[model samples]
Target: MKIGLYFGTFNPIHIGHLIIANHMVEYSDLDQIWMVVTPHNPLKKKDTLLDDYQRLYLVNLATEEYPKIKPSDVEFKLPQPNYTVNTLAYLQDKFRQHDFSLIMGEDNLKSLHKWKNYEVILQNHDIYIYPRVSPEIENLELKNHSKIHIIDAPIVEISSTFIRENIKSKKNIQPLLPCKVWEYIDHNNFYRK
Candidate 1:
């Protein structure tokens, strides 16, 4: 099976995420999309994030109805400060029958060189890039690599940060989130200071 791993904090899983994952699975050659929930990202601030399980739960809630998309907690079992390369190595070992690829935005591609052992990731797995509203230029060599595929997915502008900020401000951000996720956040009073 060919799986595209879509890694994110998923502070709260929203519609934009679903749209991208669905698009990738249906529009591309990938058989499934795994929404990998990171326990801790080296580049992001841990203090601002909700509990890891809470975010994972939201991902579950958001993805339950989509058969092609599923939530993954693979990063939780591994050490903290998760790196894509390590997770990929573990998954490759465990699921020897599956061919794993990366699902990322154009912005992330621009900064791929900074990731730990990024060259290994590029060499072993194919990377599926989705469109993002990023102005930064990507490394030409990396962008044009045979293993890198720039998918013509929709340019989703919605972000978890935007959703969180609106929720904190008591704005009606229900449309931005999955119905179940929005309901859970409202009941639990998440992101509301």
Candidate 2:
């Protein structure tokens, strides 16, 4: 089976995430999209990030309805400062029967040259890039690479940062979150300052 690994912190999974996962499964060659919930991103600040387990739980709640798109806590058991290269290598070793690909945005592709062993990643696996609002990644050098596939997926403008800000101000974030996830966040008072 072909699997696409969509790695993210998932501080709170939102509609945009769901839309992309659904699109990857339905429109792309990916048989499944595993939402790899990273516990700690090497490049991001952790102050605003929810606890790893909580973020993983929210991801699970948000993706529960989609069988093809599920939450993966694989990083939680791995080392800190989770890097995509390490996770990909570990997963490849463990799930040899499945073909794994990386799912990311054009923005990430623009900065991928800075990632650990990026050249190795490009040579070994295909990347499914989705459109982002940013214009900077439009001129990426790797755009023409045979391993790069631009997916015409639905683009949702929502971001986890926006949802967290709204929650902090006691605003209704229901529109951006799945119903069960919204309820869980509401009941647990997550992302409150």
CA deviation > 4 Å runs, candidate 1: 41-45, 135-139
lDDT of 1 by residue, 55-112 (tens): 9999999999999998999999998777899999999999999999999998889889
Per-prediction TM-score, please? Answer: 0.94, 0.94
Candidate 2 per-residue lDDT, tens place, 64-146, comes to 88999989999888987677888889999999998899999998898889999999899989999999887776677898899
Clashing pairs in 2: none
Clashes of each: 0, 0
